[model samples]
Target: MKKFDVLTPIGLVVGVVMLIFGIVTNGGITGFFSFIDPASLLIVLGGVIAGLLINFPVKDMKHIFTVIKQGFSQNEQNLDQLIKTFVTLSERARREGLLALEVEIEKVKDPFIRKGVLLAVDGIEPDMINDIMSAEITAMEERHRKGRNILEKAGEYAPAWGMIGTLIGLVLMLKNLNDPSSLGPNMAVALLTTLYGTLFANLVCLPLASKLALKTDQEVFLKQIIIEGVIGVQAGQNPKLLEEKLSAFLSSKERQKAAELITSGEALNDEA
Candidate 1:
C-alpha cells in the first residue's frame, strides 16, 4: 500500500521520448510543429472512441474504465502468496475444525476468495458450493470479457481511424492541387496520424488486450484451483492429501518451496 511499483505508463513515455529524439535527429524541432495537424488528431481520436462505443455496450464500457485505470495501477497482484496461503489454510482446517479458519478468513484481503472459503467451511455441500462459486465465476468472466472486448474494439478502431484521418488530409490536399509546395507537409501530417493509429492499434491496444486476456485466464485458473480445494476441504479429506492437491496451483518454484516446508516440518516432528 505504501507508494511503490511502476505507475508510469510505459507506452506513452516511450512514445514521447522516441518522438522527441526522432524530431531532433531528423530535421530539428521546428519541423515537428511545421507539420502539426490538429484535424488529423481529432479524426483519429473521435473515430476510435465512436467506433468502440458502437461495438460494445455501456456495461462493457464500464469494464473498460477499470481496464484503463489498471493501465496506471502500480500494484502487482502476486498470486504465489495467495496459493501458498490458501493451501496452508486448507491444511489447517483439516487439522482443526472448520471454525478454526474463521479468524484467517477475516484476514484475507480478497473478499471473493475468502467468501468462497468460508462458504465451504460452513459445511455447504459440494454441489451447492459449485453452484455459488460457478455463478460468481460467470459474473467475473462476463465482466472481464467486456473489458477485453473494449480493448479489442479500440485496437480495431485505431487503424480505421488512421485511414479516415489520412483520407481527410488527402482530400484537403487535392482541393489545393495547384499548391504543389503545400503537398509534402500536408501528406506528412496525413500519413503521421495513420502511422500513429496503426502503431497504437498493433503495438499498444492489441498487446494490452492480450495481456489482460492472459491475466484473466490465469486468475480464472487460480480460482478454479481454489474451488476444487474448497470443495475438497469441505468433504474433509486428509490434510496431507489436501495440501498435495492444492499444491497444484503453485508454479514449479513454489512447488519446490512447499515440498521443503513439508519435509522440514516432518524432520522436526521425527526429531521431537
Candidate 2:
C-alpha cells in the first residue's frame, strides 16, 4: 500500500512477481546467500544519509518527506470540478463587475484563487496581471525542479560511495590474506556495499525525484487555468464563450456539464 494504490497496483504486482521468478530460477535461497554482506551496506547507507544532510536544509528535507508521504495516498482530482469552479467564478465576475467582488476575493480559501480574484477585482490590466502570474508560476516550477535535482544528485553519489566502501573493505581483506578466518569478514563488506547502493538508488532516491517532477508539471497546468480564466472574466468576455475556453482545461465529461449549464439544460445553485 505504501508503494502503490489501486491506480498503479498491476504494474507493481508484475514487477514483484518477475523479481521472485528470477530469484527462484537462479537457485533461490542458495543464490541469495551470496549477496549478504553487512559492511557494504554500512558504507552505502552512511554515505547516502551524510550526503542528504549536507546538501539539503532541514526545512527542505521535511518537505521532501511530506511529498513522499502524500504521493502514495493523494487522491485523483476530477477535472470536471475544476472546470465548474472556473465557470462559476467567471459568471459571477461578469454579473457583479469587478468592484462588487472585493468581498469574494477576501473570502476565497486557496491562496492562488485569492490572488487571482484580488487582481481581477482591482481592475488590473489583464495582460500585465497575466505576465506577473506567469512569471510567478515559472519560478515555482523552478523550485520544484531544484528539489528533484537534489535527490537525483544524491542517488548518483550513493552508488559511488558504495564503491568507495568496497575499496576500503578490499584493502583490509588483502592485508589479512594470510588468515582464512579474516578473509570472510572482508569479503562480506565488499559485497554488502554494492547491494546497499543498488537498493537505495532504485527503491528510494530515484523514485522520489521522478514523482516530484511529475507533481510539478501537474501544478503548473492547474495554475495556468486560473490565470486564463480570471483574465477572461476581467475582460468581460461572453459568459458562454468564457465557459468554452475554461472548459478546455477539463476532460470531455466536465466540458459537457459546462455546456449544459450554458445551454440552460442544467440549473446550478451558485448562479443567481
Winning model by lDDT: 1
Off by over 4 Å in 1: 1-8, 74-80, 259-272
Q: What digit string (tens of lDDT, one per residue) describes model 1 on residues 165-237? A: 7887788789878999988867876797797788778777887777667767766776787788677767777
Candidate 2 stretches with Cα past 4 Å from truth are 1-36, 57-59, 73-75, 103-108, 251-254, 257-272
TM agreement with the true structure for every prediction: 0.81, 0.79
Model 1 clashing-pair count? 0
Which window of 10 residues has the lowest lDDT sum in candidate 2?
263-272
Each model's lDDT comes to: 0.71, 0.70
In model 1, how large is the Cα lDDT of residue 149? Answer: 77
Instruction: For residues 22-91, write the lDDT of model 2, one tens digit per residue.
Output: 7678968776666666657768878887888888788777777565554454334444444555565666
Q: Deviation in angstroms for 65 in model 2?
A: 2.5
**lDDT over C-alpha atoms for residue 27 of model 1:** 71
Q: How many clashing residue pairs appear in each of the predictions shown?
A: 0, 2
